[model samples]
Target: MIREEVKIISKEYLNKDVLKIRFEKPKEFQYKPGQFINIKFEQEGSFRMRAYSILNTPSEETLDICLKIIPNGLASESFKEAKENDKYTIIGPFGYFQLNENEKEHVFISTGTGVVPFINIIKEFVKKDYKMTLIAGYKKQENIICHEELKKIEQENKNFVYKPTITREEWGGLKGRVQKHLPENLSKKMFYICGLKEFVIETKESLLEKGVNEKYIKVERYN
Candidate 1:
């Protein structure tokens, strides 16, 4: 896909190595909440592309992406150096991870940068007053991104619930993977999960064991 120049509007740190960057896209840009965009940057001798989920509401003029920096990672390194007003090529709002608008109850399960897409979807759900639950798993409380924002959502909407889990830290929130928090009864709700390969697989198994219909579950896996 050909890339279009998108102007950076703002950037902020979410955690130790994660960044939330907002950019300005064309007014006509329209994409589903869980869709992703392909970003390209030149390093060494070539331009490499990486996929990142869109982290803002579709109705908004600004586009956002939650990026996690990894050692020797091309896209994250280049993005870390990007400043406001800088422009770069963005290829798409792709992928099929999206909410079923007709479904009244929904569960969003995520870990690390996998939480980005859920953030976008939850924002829309809040605007529309949809019933939802967010289960985020991290290594520690400090590793949970968007902590304050999610807490506010939970407070403002009685239908919304946020649960943060830590696998390696002793914290006040739920300790363990999101799989530990799946409702005892899952016959009536929809489920969405995004995360590392193993995490996704394990969560899927747990949900199946709890009686969540296979067709009602959606997942996006990242290595």
Candidate 2:
């Protein structure tokens, strides 16, 4: 890991609670698509930090982080008020939640803001011949994030499929949690899951019960 102070290039709200921040990439800094960075700042004379997954592919010139704001959250509150040119110390290129380059058939499951890393992975690695299925879960239609971009990817790449489901509100698309929308067959496919702890646990268990080898499943959990 390396420590560097970077300037925020811009900030925008992607949804009601999700903020997308772009930072100036430091010279000589490099990171894989699915990694994350820890942003550190000072509050009340004490240092505070939070880790957010990198949302931009390595081919992008800048670094992007998608943050889900929470009520009274220290880091979230601070980031909500952050402005362009603001400088913060970041340390990382952390986490092993990356893609297997050789895998042709891949399945990704994410809930809410947990979809960040998958966005990076797909944009960076998905190719014309690669078959990828993305199953995203949200509480309501308004809670869905990055749907437009995912849809564009699906439209442009015939091999890619996007499935978004809502749990609390009715929609024309599928309803219920992502686990319920998972594909029935798991053979010869790799699965990547990210979401709340319970969602990850339940999905992993369901996959295991369906005879998916643990080796073919990769998971990252959020609180």
Question: TM-score per candidate, in order?
Answer: 0.94, 0.96
Q: Residue 82 in model 1: shift from native, Å?
A: 2.3
Model 1 stretches with alpha carbons more than 4 Å out: none
For all candidates, the clash counts are: 0, 0
Poorest lDDT segment (10 consecutive residues) of candidate 2: 123-132
Candidate with top lDDT is: 2
Root mean square deviation (Cα) for candidate 1: 1.7
lDDT value, residue 165 of candidate 1: 89
Task: Kindly list the per-residue Cα lDDT of model 1 for residues 21-131, writing each as its tens digit.
Answer: 998887667788889988877777898888899888888888888888887788877888889998888888688999988888899999998999998899887768578
State the TM-score for model 1. Answer: 0.94
lDDT score, residue 219, model 2? 93
Q: List the residue pairs that clash in candidate 1.
A: none
